[model samples]
Target: MYSSLRSLADDTFCLRLQRAARVWRKVSDEELSNLNLSEATTTPLWLINKLGEGLRQRTLAEHMGLEGQSLVRLLDQLESAGLVVRRDDPSDRRAKALYLTDAGRKLAEQAELVVRKIRARLLDGVPAEHLAIVDGVFDKIITAAID
Candidate 1:
């Protein structure tokens, strides 16, 4: 039985959103594992690749919505893994700039393809117009939550 929009939004929307996120992550992790990557592990590499090289560490943390120290730990692990490196920023010696190694760039590209495959599978039959509308709603919700 269909319910009122207000009721559904108030009671079910958040749950559905959370479930969708969980499912997306689960599928993404499983697929990425084929390349010896997991969502948590691939995220920083992918983000750096997407945003371009020499991104400031503080900027990366802000983009990731992570605290600086928390991001530092991840960066340490990535550096040790030889996927990323931190260089002293030319403009600010105390600030670190992040860059992906050749291996990291290659892995990031592969992870990107795998993510696209998972996204395509999940949105196989979704109408573009409906997706646009949903995206608009999501944008507003995100803005409201952040504000």
Candidate 2:
């Protein structure tokens, strides 16, 4: 039966977390596919929506933890899809600013709804107190990893 829970140890938490992340990503990918989007495009789209027009490509790349060329490739795809645009930065003639097209803005709204649904499903039955603790733990882990 499901007797392995009896033998679960504290040290296995990280392994469990990794498995959970993988599963979540799989589910998210599947859900996003219905909208003709993938996980790769979700964050950047959301960021563009949140940061508004005139967001620099370099700034978005930094926030996304992606290299310049990598971000450019993703942006290229978005631009080709007509979901985003790259305008010349007025203050910096050499740099490009990121902006969502009208279509991009509509997709961003849909993305937000999808994200809300996913979060609700994922957090279902999880107590708020427990989630707060988990959030704090994640912050600590991220800070430790960065340092």
Candidate 3:
């Protein structure tokens, strides 16, 4: 009986975490849309900018937890918008290196600001100690999942 109760509690905790993730993504997407970006594009752009111009698509996709084809589509759109460029990798002729264009860099900066504001709003009432605990819990969760 005790084991069953523990299992139920664990399940409920997982469900709550999933629900929170969904809500956060939905809200983020809506906010990003106003800046002519989607949840998909904003993170990639920001990461590319931070990672520097010669970052590989595969690396970016891995960091973003996306499949290759999905990342390709996002890159296609970004390229068409003149926000990103896929340059031929000097070391590997077949591979393309990802780089943000001038426009992309500008947008990335703005995206950073937007993200900061959004994070502030989302964490407004949360106490620092609570946030630290949550952060630690997430770190453990991610580590466990990865292993």
| Best-fitting candidate, scored by lDDT | 3
Candidates' lDDT values, in order?
0.89, 0.87, 0.90
> Where in model 3 is the C-alpha error above 4 Å?
1-3
In model 3, which residue pairs have backbone atoms overlapping below 3 Å?
none
In candidate 2, stretches whose alpha carbon ends up further than 4 angstroms from where it belongs are: 1-11
- The candidate 1 region of ten consecutive residues with least summed lDDT is 1-10
- Candidate 1 residues 1-147, lDDT tens each? 457788877768889988998998899889998988888778899999999899999999877778898899888888888999999999999999999999999999999999998989999999999999989988898778779
lDDT of 2 by residue, 50-143 (tens): 9888899999987887889999988988999999999999999999999999999999889878878988999999999999999999889877
lDDT of 3 by residue, 63-102 (tens): 8878899999999999999999999999998889998989
Best by TM-score: 3
Winner on TM-score between 1 and 3 is: 3
- How high is each candidate's TM-score? 0.87, 0.83, 0.88
Using lDDT as the measure, what is the rank order of every candidate, best first?
Answer: 3, 1, 2
Clashing pairs in 2: none
Q: What is the C-alpha RMSD of each candidate to the true structure, in Å?
A: 2.7, 4.2, 2.1
